[model samples]
Target: MKKLTLFASAFLLSLGSYAQQALWGGTNLVSPQINEDKTVTFRIHAPKASKVEIEGDFLPPTKVDTPFGPQDIPSRAPFKEGKNGVWEYTSSVLPSELYSYSLYVNDLKMPDPNNVYQNRDIATMTNIFLIGGGQADNYMVQEVPHGTVAKVWYSSPGLGMEARRMTVYTPAGYESSKKKYPVLYLLHGAGGDENAWTELGRAAQILDNLIAQGKAEPMIVVMPNGNGAQEAAPGEAPNSMVKPSFMNPKTMDGAIEKAFPDVMKYIEKNYRVYTDKNHRAIAGLSMGGFHSLYISAYYPNKFGYVGLFSAATSKQVNKGVTSDVYENLEDKLAVQFKNAPKLYWIGIGKTDFLYKDNMDFRKILDNNGYKYTYMETDGGHIWKNWRIYLTEFVPLLFK
Candidate 1:
């Protein structure tokens, strides 16, 4: 055992030395150097490549036509030609927000070799940076008390899964303290899993900062996979390791709403959480929004607070399928309202594809004399708006 351990240690040391050498090789090269001003300078060393360009949310968005409507996607801009084999581009002054950028060399996508800070959204990986000083600061990690995030597995018999995974975020002092905390069930959009809010939405950072500054109540945030068919995120499961597509037919088909009780049950059983309508909140984005809507309406007296962030207000039409979860919508809303949830909050971007759908849903609420809070911001269906909504919505919970 000693001999084997020593051999493994030597191999790891050699590997570490190699990594150090490779990292220090580009010590003088800085790809993304945040300037004194907010403008950012990006660099890439592609001497042989005929062309180099960058695509990111930092640039003017490109509007593209989709089935729902024209949606704004990231725009691409060319980088200046090579200077001493270093290709570069300096962006215009940007606002405070999290930004992601992808590099292209000779029309082929490539990761920025110089920047190690990157995040994978589905199959594509892009380098990311935060231009802080405003709302973006809420998404950043600061010298505040951090929270505990656990990937817990629980039985979901309602969904026909014996055990499934979820991401739970407990406040900074949760483990040491005995007092019970309220819970916010934070669902993700289509193509997202339990990890989405923590990674892309910055749920943990936002929660930590809010609680530290006493801007919001300290509550447990539960992020579950809304897709009823999947046991967990793509690679985390025992199934295929291939990248999951951006859309899944199984999501938002009334099944998640039917099975939501399993999730709530697991949380209430394992964690130290208050068990009542007033102490429970549920919110989601896109398909998650749809799930939130139907789930809250289906379980009328369950949640005190309901937030719909750019949610799909309409249920997906499945032919030859009848479910109690999807039927009697206005009746359910009537009951949901009669019970009088403390907040029925809705937020969406002006240019989002689902903007009209949301407006139409609001019309239903208006005609029925149901009162709710609404917020409209400038942007399309994107993470920027969802993150903003989360930061805004969380503070209003349990207050």
Candidate 2:
């Protein structure tokens, strides 16, 4: 009986040693490992999961033969399960870009546990990875003089909201320099708050790289919460996770438009900003674009530069216009043109769903004899396009 007991102990020790050796000798299991040729390999450990799939913007485009010709569709693929609960997938060579992805484990989407870099778009969160080179390198943080981004709270009497939050970016030498700097009121799209630009858009990195390269001027950027009802993002709000009302045109009526004065008042009172319209610029993506257009038009001569990136031109005026505020939008735009901004710029992607609306709005600008520059590029209404638009638009401001 003693000899049998000793034999059992020896057998258990050998099994434990083999298990440790197998784990230590295997690959390190690094998720999102960028290859020499720009392809990426992603891995996740989910031993209990029945199936896993990887979906992201970095996947190679699928070519579908359409009536018009071949159309490229975004792709998602299943991850192959390997030994010891490891699931892995290798992507085809992708363009140099910042991509967001999530794993579908047992059909439930979740951010990658292995990837530390994550981004929040509205309520959904996803993992992010960058394939660097070309324009994408600009999005990455580099060895350059950086700016300070602050989340600030201020009074908004205009909207009858006592306090609100905004994200402000001051240039590298702003604190040291005695000279006042130009201000750009940057706005985000629907379902987004002031944090959108800095998070998904990588606004700070872009600004730092641009200023370092002398591609953009040294200026301050103010990103205000476009949703009038919500003071800040999800957890930062007075009541955590307040439903965003920016999507409802009726809810926005007189809210954001009236609150503009308060936002400017708070900024002017606290920050050293250029007071004139020439040094004042306003721009936004999607819904924010619509706001910028109307705000600039409503208060003609207030903004010298106006940029719209895939703006919701179709819904410029609310469906039910009981008040005369937006009744004479055309006249307002005419007056705005008469005042003449230094730069009236419009940028839209070729495949954007709002392309038709943007074109129709351009006709109105044409009819009013408005002088503006138009830029068309690839891709649809995505953050990638917005970031590109921002990089292009900033270089033209404060010139």
Candidate 3:
């Protein structure tokens, strides 16, 4: 009798696992189906629970990353209790390009067994929702004029890493056309990898739109792994935490100067790229931004245009008055401005925590008689503002 009972328990467990797998088979529970009313419905049938609601980045113009973009729908509607004794709720959200959401019961974030688009990149599973089903043209890998995206690997002697790989997006007509194109070295932020710009920033689409509109010159964009550690960028093992390393010039110089030059030499020799300072540009976000500032200044002759977007420039913090990121390096950086670089552009959101730093940096430049452009918009440190900044900054490159 005990043997029979054990067999029954094992069979039941296997059946439950199969059922769970089937539930998340198709669309994934995280991607809610958009009803004709333009309303989104998120359902979790935990009927035992007294309360439940949906939360996510449904609202627009709101901070998504920092404040955490999620909203709780009031549970006024009666939840239909499923056979498994679970409750569910559906809510509507205004349309947008993309969003992230999840079910929260009381305060715990619950996973949707029915939704398949759930991303478990973070420790807690989060639901990913896309409302406006546009081409995401900004993020698409295109075949126009024929640009090639190659995943290539290299060894970095500076950081003592072997087999470091990155994505290089060559513009259309790169293969057939003998014309050498300008290169834009773009960097991603913290919690992002080499593919961040291509995936989330819609980099190709932005470049396509700009080129088509005659707003910007067509160029190759090299997205490198900003983290010194090799495993970090690919989400592989041996991942190292990314911190603000711009304050320490020794480390920044070692990584950017020695390690990055290897990437440049490899590109120039293999690809049909322009090998001059006038055709080279570098820009980045957050930690990448600090790298941009210091890297450009340190090696002024290497790049012509520099862009900083929503960056953390200093280790020192200011309540609302000033930033020390550029304070110590002011005199040395001024020499870079005096010597090379056609365009030195800095972009930041007014409400961003780094706003004061940006403003203070601008003042330092102004005080030093440096000619640069400063862009101020309404936003915090988020991708929305960075997207806008990229659109604006790319056009000014190689001009």
lDDT of 1 by residue, 194-295 (tens): 999999999999999999999999999999998788888889988748678777656756678888999999999999999999999999999889889999
Ranking by TM-score: 1, 2, 3
lDDT tens string, model 3, 73-127? Answer: 2122334445565555566545445455667666666665566665432133566
How many angstroms is residue 275 displaced in model 1 relative to the true structure, after the best TM-score fit? 0.5
- Model 1: lDDT equals 0.90
Write down the RMSD of all candidates, one decimal each.
3.5, 6.9, 6.8
- In candidate 1, stretches whose alpha carbon ends up further than 4 angstroms from where it belongs are 1-27, 316-321
- Model 2 sits at a Cα RMSD from the real structure of 6.9
lDDT of 2: 0.85
* lDDT on C-alpha atoms for all candidate structures: 0.90, 0.85, 0.67
- The clash numbers for all candidates, in the given order, read 0, 0, 19
Once fitted onto the true fold, the runs of candidate 2 whose alpha carbons sit more than 4 angstroms away are 1-28, 60-74, 242-251, 321-323
Better of 2 and 3 by lDDT: 2
Q: After best superposition, candidate 1 residue 84: deviation in angstroms?
A: 1.9
Give the best candidate by lDDT: 1
Estimate TM-scores for all models: 0.93, 0.87, 0.73
Cα lDDT for residue 282, candidate 2: 97
Q: Quick one: best TM-score, which candidate?
A: 1
Note the residue pairs that clash in candidate 1.
none
